[model samples]
Every structure is written in C-alpha cells, then in structure tokens.
Target chain A: MIPVLGGSGPVIPSFGSGSSCEQNNGWWCTDWLREHWGDTLQPALVQHIELVAIAIAAGFLIASVLAIAGFRYRLLDVPVGGFADFLYTIPSIALFQLLVPFTGLTVLTVEIALTSYTLFVLYRNMVAGLRGVPEDALEAARGMGLTRVQTFFRVELPLASPAVLAGLRIATVSTVSIATVAAFVVPKGLGEPIFIGLDQNLFKTEILAAGGLAILLALAADVALAWFARAVTPWSRA
Target chain B: MSVLADQFTAHTFVDAFRFIGDNASLMLSKTGQTCELAFAALGIALALALPLGLWLGHRHRGLFLALGVSTLGRALPIIVLIAFGLTVLGVGFWNNTAALVVLGIPPILTNAYFAVDGADRDAVEAARGMGLTERQVLLRIELPLGLPLIVAGVRISAVFVIASATIAAIAGGGGLGDIIVNQASYGLAGVIAGSLCVSAVALLTALALGLVHRAVSRSTTARA
Candidate 1:
C-alpha cells in the first residue's frame, strides 16, 4: 500500500551514481529514469491517476445531482451556478491550503479541493445538455404514454449525451492538470516528484520526467474521452 | 518584531485576521507584488495575443491554430510550466511572468478570434458595400462587435494570472505565496491570511473585469 502523508519516505532517493549525466545535471537522464522507473516514477504516476479518478468520480456524482435538480427547478440554476463560479475562481493552491485548517494535511483535503474545481465545468455542461434536449422529442415520448422517468431515460439523456460527454472530456483533462498541484497539500500524485525535485537542489531529471508524464496523461485522457464519447453516442455520429 | 511574531502564531480565524492586521504593511506589499506580476503578464499576453488574434480573425483564417492553442494551453499545468521555466530561465520575476503570459494567451486569443470571426457577416458585407476598406471594416466593425468577447477573454486571463501568480513565490518570485509557502516562519495563521488575500485579489479581479465585460457588451449592443 502507498504510504500516506507524513509517513511517506523521501520521494527521490539519492542514487549517488558516477554517470556523466548525473554529475552534469542533464535535463533528460535516461539512465536515472531506467533505474527509478518502477520504484519511483511508476508509483507517482499511479498515485496521480488515482487522485484524478477519485476527484472526477466524486465531482461527477455531486454535479449530476445538482444538474438534475437545477434542471427540474430552473430557479435554482442561478445560485447553483454562482456558487460553482465562486469555487472556480479560487486558485487550486489557495483552496488546498484553505482546507488544511479544517481537513488537516490529508488526502481528503486534496480531494475536496480537486472535487470542487470540477463542479463548475461538469454542472454547466450537464445542465446545458439536459436543457438542449428537443422539446418535440419529449412531446413524442409523452404522446407514446412514456412516464417522466422513462422519457428522461430514453429521450433526454441520450440527446444530452454529447454535451455531457464533452463536459467530461474538459473536466477530466483539467482535473489531471490541477491534481498535480494537490501534491503541495498531500505528498501524492505526479506533483510529488515535481516538488521533491524542486526541493532537492532542482533535480532536473526527476522534474522533467514527472512533468512530462503529467502532460502526456492529460493529452491521453483527452483523446480517450473523445473516442469514448464517439463510441457511446453512435447515433450522433450519423 | 516580537509582537508580529506573536500575531503570526495565530491558529483560529480571528487570529488569522489579527495576523493580517498586524502585518498590514507586509500583506499590502505582497498583494501589490501579486497585482504587479499578474497585470504585467496580462499586459504582455494582451499585446501578443490581441493583434495576432485580430488579424487571423479578420481574415477568417487560422481557426485550427486558435482553438488548438487554447486546448493545448488548458492541458498544460501552470505549475509544470513554471518548473520548466525554472529549468531554462532560472528563478526570477521574468520566469514567473513568462509562464503566466503563456497561461493568459490562449483564452484571449481564442476569444478574440471567435469574437471577430463571428461578427455578423451581413453587417460586414454592408460595410464593404459602403466602400469601406478591409482594414477600416475590420477596425470599425469587427473590433467593436467583438469587444465584449475580447473583454470577457481578458477577464478570464486576468483571473487566471492573479490566481497562478501565487505559485510564483515557490520559484523565488515575490508574491503572497511567500507567506503561504513558508509556513514554518509565518505560521498557519499567516498562511491562511495569505491564502485569503490571494483569493480576494483573484475574486476582485474577476469582478472588476466582469463589470468591464458587461459594460463593453452593453455599449456595443446599444451602438447596434
């Protein structure tokens, strides 16, 4: 099991290698990466993924409830949106630090901050998608003796899938990027190496590796989500 | 100095407010530095993105590039960008400023481009029919029409720069982040105070620019 905060050992252990790249502080040290890939880099990547997954999952659940309620009662839309906008305006770093007094320096603090960031994008898109469902389609469903629940499931949701999936794409990509900052609060995710490298005399190799992996992960998630959206909404392709 | 130290030891919200009060000068200076860095970057970003966005948008070209830049910008984390800057540019004001300028560019550029490109084609044609040169049409017509979105773009970038500027302190750049990051010296109350200040600056910037956006759009619509 991955060690939690204050207990996790030094992120980058000193290898004390006599290699030329290590001595010269080269930007991309292949030798160092090959040596620490499993013990260091891989775990950081896994932790980063876990942070993003948990935050997005939690954010999606909350945003869905908010979106549905806002859609049912249009009056709640302004206040709910205003709250999300308020959350979005706060920087990730500041939000994390602000939570520390309440949640302490734990993964929960990091996740709470990360989850809040996702709500604006996710809730906006979900509501827009639901509202964008054609009125005629809803009417047809009603004429066919479909109940409100059935009409929503069979008609509204599928119609709104494109916008909702688009929101997920954006929320996922951004959450991946923001999750790196969570390291400043909890010593987990790709940010750990980036911060550790900064603290450890600006270890060039570790910083580059971790930062590069984060960018790659975001791009990959974006592409995968785009593809998934297409695959799920086959009718939209036509 | 001893009194300041005692205030820094604050733990509760009231104590945090006291810390801000005692360190009023320090807080003010840090807040000013944050504004300086944020505005400097925003200025540079506007100068660079506005003209380019305007030109491309006027010609109805480079849609792909405009959208791609914003998408790429969104995907790249500001912290990682700052780390990269530290490696190449070394730690200083310019390093932080440059990273922030990159952060600010995409939104402004995308909005500017769209703002111009999406201006009413019929109005544009009508202007052209009245013997306006392409430059005149662009400057007189598209720019006014797109002003709202451009302002909105600036509003977004301003908020981003102010918020991200807090992290510049980690790279030896002076800002409110200094108090927050050096928790051992400033204490938890100081850190909270700094965090509150950063959020306040960011929210205020957004609010101010939001007013600008509304005003610009309102004036433009009234003109129409």
Candidate 2:
C-alpha cells in the first residue's frame, strides 16, 4: 500500500546490509565487474557523459545569449531571474513527471528539464561577471580606441572569464548529479544500475559502484573546469 | 503539449482541487513532516556549522577547510547520499536526517565564515581600539553585522532542504514524495496536486526567507 501522508500505524523502517565497497566482498569481486562492465557500466557512463555534455552546452549557450541581451535591455533582469528561480524551485521528480507525459520519457525530456535547472546558476553568474568588469578597465579600452565590439570580446569577456567559468564549473558538477535522475525517465546512466540495485535488493556493490562513479565524475569535471578557468585567465595569476 | 494542456482542463482542475481538499489533512500532515525533516536537519547543521564557522571566521584560520567543505558538499549528490544512508546506516529517520544535515551544512558554514571573516576591517579595528574583549567584539559587533549574510546562507540551505525533503519519501521518511511517487495509482490529478503543493511550499519558504534576509540587510546597512 502507498503510504498516505496521515496513514495509521507506525511506519516501519526497512534495512539493507551495512557494507562498504572497500571492505565488502561484493564490489571487490573483479569477476563481477568483468562480467557486468561491458554491458552495464560502460554504456551507462557514456550515456551519462552524453546527457551531461548536451545539457551543460545548451544551458551555456542559452544563458550566454540571455545574459548578453540582459545587458542591452535592463528590463530583462528581474523576469529572467524570476523564471529561473521558479524552475529551480520545482522538485526533480515532479519536473520529470510533468515532462514525461509530453516528451515521452525521451532524452529530450530529460535534457529540457536539466537545461532549465542550469539557467539559474549560469545566467546569474554570467551576468554578474559581465557587470563586474571594472569601470577603469572599460575606460582604458575606450581610450585605446577599441570599438564596443572589440572591447566586449577582448576586455569584458576575458575579464569576466573567472566568474563565468566558476558558473560553468558549478553548472557542470550539478548537471552530473541531476543527470542521475534520468534513469527514471530513460534506462540510461549509472542511475539505472543504482535504482535497479535498490529495487531488487541486489546488495551494496551496485549502489556503491554507481554512486561512487557519479561522485568521481563530478569531482573530475570540477577539477577539469578549474584547470580550464586558470588556463583562460592567466592574467589573474599575474 | 497536449498532456500539459490536459492537466489544466476544467475536469482535471476540479479533480485536482477536490483531491487536495479531500486529502487536505494528509497534505498538511505530509507538509508538516517535510517541514520537520528540513528544520531538524537545519538545526543539526547550524549546531555543527555555527561554532566551527564562527571560530574559524573569527580566527581567520582554515580557509582551505572552508573551501574543501563547500566543494565536497556540492559534489556529493543528495540522492547518492540518501542511497548510501539507506544501504549503510539502514533506513530510518536518523539515516535520512543525517544525509540531509550533511546536505545543509556547507552553505551555512561557508556563508558564516565569509560573513564574519569579511566583516568590515575598519569597524573591527575600531571595536578593538575601544578595548572591547574578543568575545564582546564577536558577540556584540561581528555577530550583528554578519547576521544578514548568515541568514541569507540559512535561506539557501532552507530552500534546498525543503525541496529535497520530497526525496525522503523514497526511504520511508514520509513527505509529499510518497504521494508523488504513487501517481500511477492516484492518477495524474493526484500527481499534479502533490506537485503544486510541493512547489508552493518551496517557493513560499524561499520568498519568506528572502524577505527576512532583505530586511536584515537593510537594517544592518541603515545602522551603518
């Protein structure tokens, strides 16, 4: 029976074995991974990466355009922020349920929701970075006879790289995490194994392996973006 | 698009509203549970984060520790944490609350550290010049000045916790998620109703906290 909000009787807590992957005999069995790796982990990882990349790339493009336009029309600021905030407030499961009926549990459905989540983080930071360009720096660019276009590309954008990249780092890491929920809509990613393992009582190995991989993916993405940010903003180091 | 449109049809709208009315008590109870879960987690987080954050911020020590905690907090997915809690610690309120408290800590700690550490140097120097004791300066001066951003941090954590409490339903922790996940049996109307309730609660919480944050910041600035 579905547990109603005010159901009668005390709710019983279910227990699963308390085992760590490092100490557990389950995940430590190389034979188990070897058997499952080809069909399970590899494809799931690939799909996970694909979903994250598409969402982040699309989010970045949309946020960049919106941020640029926001600079032109100050009126866009509050509405854009409000819309993003509204989207951010929606629960992930509710979001998936709402979209699935329309988009039919496809990657597009997942991407739409995922991309929307990124807008709040990306748009806010990008705008802040753009607006944060020093007035003196702008004056110098104008004094040097740089056109509005040249100054934007050469001065404003480069100066804003740190903030924008920080946003990108945040968006990318979060995307990796939220993308796990994609397993509910479509049979893809580490989430598939994790959820399946949970439902089937397949022990700690599947859950640990998939969850650990997702965490590792987030860490790796964050580090890579940090390195990229440093590479692009060499003057910050100077 | 049709499905989205279908959801707002007069029949569905009536059904949704009626469902909400019929389940009003249950809805309120569930919302209460979600609120309890969030506040309990927040309380635990504040207890741990406040002292640590204040001490470090006051001493200006362990900037790296602050950064490291924030990074780990972001990188650790809540779902993953819940899954770990369920499997490792066994499914109960304690495990679920532990996971949420972990989720709530980073923002509180990071913002508190930033607030106290970044308090106006000149004002702090003046306080010191007046022969104010360290404890007095922190309690009387720094705490009041840092209150706004600290509240802002709590606002962030609060919103996050409220929205995330829905997931607690999955682990037998009871929230609106129980209704949400059972949409198959209750029909789309029930799902929509639950979704609306969750959204309303989350948005209202955020709005309320945001107002408080604004009020605090405004008063703090007015004093300055």
The numbered model that scores best in DockQ is 1
User: For each candidate, what's the DockQ?
Assistant: 0.38, 0.32
Candidate 1 structure lDDT: 0.86
Question: Tens digit of lDDT per residue, candidate 1, span A40-157?
Answer: 8899999999999999999999999999999999999999998997788776776787777667778998899999999988999999999999889989999999999999899999
What residue pairs clash in candidate 2, if any at all?
A: none
Task: State the iRMSD of every prediction, in order shown.
Answer: 5.7, 4.4
Chain A TM-score of each candidate structure, as shown: 0.90, 0.86
Deviation (Å) of B107 in candidate 2: 1.3
Q: Which stretches of candidate 1 lie over 4 Å from their true place?
A: A1-20, A134-145, A235-238, B1-11
Give the clashing pairs for model 1: none
Q: In model 1, what lDDT does residue B192 have?
A: 76
Instruction: Identify the CAPRI category of the predicted complex in candidate 1.
Output: acceptable
Chain A accuracy of model 2 expressed as TM-score? 0.86
